[model samples]
Every structure is written in structure tokens, then in C-alpha cells.
Target: MSQIERGWDAIAQLDFDAALAIASRLLNNPHLDIRHQAYRMMGMANYRKRSVQQAIPYFEHAVQLVDNYKDRFSLCMCYALLGDMDRADRLFQNIDSLWGLPVECYVSIVMCYTEPKHFQRAVDLLEKIKLSYTLLGITDQTFLAIRGQLAFHYALDAVHYVLNMVSASFDTAKWIKSFAEEMDEEGKKSLALVSDQVCHTKGPFTINQPNSRLQYPLLCKIEDVSLFEEERILGIRVLYGKLHVG
Candidate 1:
């Protein structure tokens, strides 16, 4: 097997020292792909341990080889692990520069802070998004996400936060969905503008990412499963307007 494949094999086995040794050796490989892959192996292995600091350098190296959204998210997660939320915030703030990293970056920032019950800050960020969308105005805007026309992530995260603690009531989900729909054309244009700048591949940005979907118990999913009528009612009865306090 190629050294790169061997290195990855070791990493997949959770053999950090062996993986590191293999990675250090592959670092000197002539092929850029091999070099990049080595860094990913190193970074990913560390990430599996919930220790992002060690992942940072390897991901940074990957960026030096190919500056893209994927590498940036890897590095961004490292910063998040280090509790440098400003850096994390900044990365999302400038999504134009980090588009290909998939939707996780956007999702992760809000999740990292709010999932553990950081609602007020999440709300503040959403409000900021709303204000920005308003400032852009319809004519001046391009996409809703970027133009400050609407805060999709803001709304999405808020709904998610409220959802986890509350019962699987359509009322709560409906409220969150309505808030997203409230963004005016200008806001939508701004978001589109951001999307255009980030996604140049010409097509709707919708694809089933590989093992990348965040799992949530939305009412839609519950309904799809043919949840019994009583069970569904009970689910709705559970969480009226709750919060996670840790």
C-alpha cells in the first residue's frame, strides 16, 4: 500500500502514534495530494478524540496545500475547541471566503454556542443578521443570507435550540419557520448574494452530503414515522417553551 493509504489505515484504527509516524513520513511525499491527505489523516485522528488543538496545525498545513472551505472548517473547529469563539464567529461572518466547507460551519458555530443553551447570544446574532439584512434593502441586495434580508441560520438555530428542550410540537416549529419566512426581499437578496459569491458552480446548492446531516427530532420527521396520535399529542404537551440550563 502507498504510504498515504497506510497512514490513513493507521488513523482509522485509532493508532495515533502510528498514524503520526506515518503522517510525518508522508509529509515529505512529492505528490501534493498525498501531502494534503496526510494532514487530513492527522487532523481527523485528533478530532476523533475531541481534542481540536492538535488538529489545528495539520489542517493549517492542508490549507497551505489547498485553501478551501473544507480545510478552513477543520481549522475553525480547532479554534472553537480552543474557546476562541471570536475566530469561529469571524469565519462565519466572512462566509464568502469559506464557501466550500459545506453548511456545517454555519451550523456548527450556532450549535457550539447555543446547543448547550446559549440562546440569548444566539438571538443577538440573529437580530444582528436581521438588522444587516434590513440595511441592505431590496434593490441593493443580492442574496437573502448575505444581504441581511433574513437570518436563516439565526432562525434555524433558534428553532433548533427551542426544539431540543420543548416537546415535538408543530406550534414551536411553526413559529420558528414563520420567523425565517419574515425576512423581506432585501434580506433574501443579500443571502442570495452571499450564496452566489460562495457557490460559483452554477446550480442549486443542495446535495446529500456524505454523513454530514445533523440529526434532530423535528415534528416533520415524527409525523413521517406514523407516530401514534396519543404519542404525538404527548410529545407536543411536553415542551411548551423551555430552555437548557447548564
Candidate 2:
């Protein structure tokens, strides 16, 4: 195998010493791809070793060499871990500046929401995006197709985690009810489907349903959203299930 390949292999094997040794030599490689890989390997190795402070510089340099989406994401994650929320937020916002959001970046952003400190902001952004779609009444096939690809489970999973797992100061229940109340039938279907998927129940799967099978916001009453008891119960049961899952 090539030296860079070997370095990556070592990184995968959790041999940071060997990976660093190979990466150091390849830092000056004429090929940008090799340099990017080498730095990424080193960064990942350090990150795995819990040396996040050390990993940041490698990721930073890797992004400099090749504005690769994953590399920028790694840099953003590193900054987030380092308690530099502002820097992390800037990098995330800048993601579409060059290329549109990569599929994996959606996962990264959702994972960020798992952090307690960033949870509220992440939920706010998610709610805003979902609301924008509702406001636009984006039932267009092309838009739905693109949105499905970009979001899929990440956005819903983030919301699920916050609702079920987080102990936040913010009124999460109120927000969830508000979001559901604001969505269209299709949007409600998506939310309901995600809710069911996360809760591991087969009671209602509306994402693939016909117009006749649609339910607005699925589990809550629109006229009286104050009755979110069922959702709260489901969230509790799902949280318990999630906690015990391997």
C-alpha cells in the first residue's frame, strides 16, 4: 500500500503514533489529495484518542488544503467540542458558501444538537427550516425530492432526541406543539412518520399515505394543542426504550 494509504490504515487501527509518523512525512506531498488525506487521518486519529485540542489544527490545515465538506465539518465539530460555539456556528453557516450542504453534513449538524449547550439553537434552526417549508407550501415534487434527500431522518432525529432525552430550560413541549400546529398536511405526515419511527411503533405511518390517510400533526389536537399528553407519554416510553437499546 502507498504510504498515505498505510497512514490511513494505521489511523483506522487506532495506532496514532504510526499514523502521525506517516502523516508527518506526507505533509509536504505535492498532491493535494494526499496531503488532505494525511492531515485528515492525523486529525481523526487525534480525535479518536480524545486529543481534540491536538486534532483541531490538523483538521484546520486539512480544510485549508482542500475545502472538502467533511473536513470543514470535522473542523466545525472540533470547534464545538472546544467550547468555541461561535466559530463552530460560523463554519456551519458557511457550509453552503461553496457547495450546497452535503448529505453527511446534515447528520453532523443534527449530532451537534445532541450537545446540551447547542440544543436550543439547533432546535430553533430546525424549527425555522421546517416553518419555512410550511410557509412556502412546498408540495412541489422537485422540492420534496430535494428536501427528502437533504433531511431524511436527521432533522427528525434531532427533534426526537431533544424532546425525549434532553432536560432543557426552554419549553420544548410548547415548541413541539407549535411546530406541529404550523405545518401543512404533508409536513405533518413527515413529522408523524418520524415520530413513529423514533418511537418504534407501527400505529401510524403517514409519510406514504394517500390524502385520505392523512392526519394533521398525528398525535395532537389542533383546536386544543394544550392536550399533548399522548405525545409526552410516547416520548417518555421511547426515551426509556432508547436508553435500554444497545
Candidate 3:
């Protein structure tokens, strides 16, 4: 493991600020690999702290050093953190319209577009993207790395719920009823677990530290989305979940 990765053990142990400090210095370490690894570690760290500003530079520098879709897509993440949907959208648009725009980045874009509430325009855009209404932004990759499409779908539904909450602030029952109506009989049965499914992530990575817990956003997985829910819900919570996992 590199220095940054080694320090990550300490950071994951709960030394947040200390981890940030080490990441800051090691990000520029003489070793190129260490530098990039440091940046990635810092990006994940900032993400955990919800400090989008701190993650930006690390992700930006990471973009400069790496050429693969993961790293480039990584930069779009900073845009999402900064709530700059325009830039994040544009970057994904420019990147060959590839299928793997990094699920992480896509989740962020959804968060920005669906924030506060869901507008018809947002719904239209989502439907367009989902049904291939235009297919203008499609791209092909060697293989599908669609790590958590379900997570994204569930997120959208949750956003619609939030929209209802915003539109009808005092009627929780009414809101749940309307939300439930949108669901099919089967999906309604799992509304309680919708969040549990969407919130939990399944992966093969492991690390030991005091703060490491299932609640870690890094552990949050994007499960299969329901036919009834919107992706916006997944976007908002997934972004938050990624932070905890980190």
C-alpha cells in the first residue's frame, strides 16, 4: 500500500482532521502513484466530511493525472459536491456519452437537479434519459460497470416523496398515500425496505478501523430501483451514503 493508503488506516480510525492534513501533504508527494492515491483518499475524505470544497482540488488534480473514465468521472463528483449541475452535466455530455459516467457522478447530478423539489422539467429530463427519448447522449463501454442502478432509481422516487413533502408540508399521511398510490401493490409492500435496500451497498472492499461501520456511506450500495419510484431519491441519499461509507 502507498503512504496515502497507509494513512487511510489512521483516518478511518476516526482521526478526521488529522487524516485531512496528511492527505493534503501526501497528495503532492514526489511519487506519482502516491500523489494520485493521496488525491483519491482526500476526495473520499472530503466527501465523508461533506466538505465539497476540500474534495474539489483533490479530484481536479486527480483528473489531471489519470486518463481513465473512473478518474475523469471522479472530477464530475466535485462539480456535484459544489452543486454545479451545469458543469457536471456538460462534462458527462462531453465524455463520449459513455454508459459508465460513473454511477457516483450521476447520483450527484440528480441531487443538484432534484433539490428542494421535483419540477416537471426534471421529470421530463429523467424520463427522456431513461426511455432513450432522444438517445443523443448515449455512449458504449467495454463492459457494464453499472455498479448500482437500483440505488439511482430508488433515489428518484425518494425525491418525488420529498417534493410531495415540500408541496404539502403538513400532510404526512396524504404524502405517504400519494406516494404509495404511485407504487404497484408489490412495491408498496416493500416501501419500508425500499430505503433499506437502497441504503445498503454490497461490495468486496474491506478495511479495519474504529469508525468503520455498516452505516459508512462507502458501504452504501445502489440496489435495483423500483418501477414505481423516481431516481432522485436515490441521488440525494446515495450521495449522503457515500460520505458515510468513506
The global C-alpha lDDT for each of the candidates, from Candidate 1 onward, is: 0.46, 0.52, 0.46
Best-performing candidate as measured by TM-score:
2
Q: Candidate 3 lDDT, tens digit per residue, 147-200?
A: 122222334333332332122224334433544454555445544444343223
Per-model TM-score versus the true fold: 0.47, 0.49, 0.47
Clash tally, candidates in order: 22, 0, 23
How accurate locally is residue 141 in candidate 3, as Cα lDDT from 0 to 100?
17
Best by lDDT: 2
* Model 3 TM-score (2 dp): 0.47
Candidate 3, superposed: residue stretches over 4 Å from native: 10-14, 96-99, 102-105, 115-246
Provide the lDDT at 209 for model 2: 34
Deviating ranges (above 4 Å) for candidate 2: 114-117, 124-246
Error of 3 at 215 (Å): 30
Worst 10 residues of 1 by lDDT: 231-240
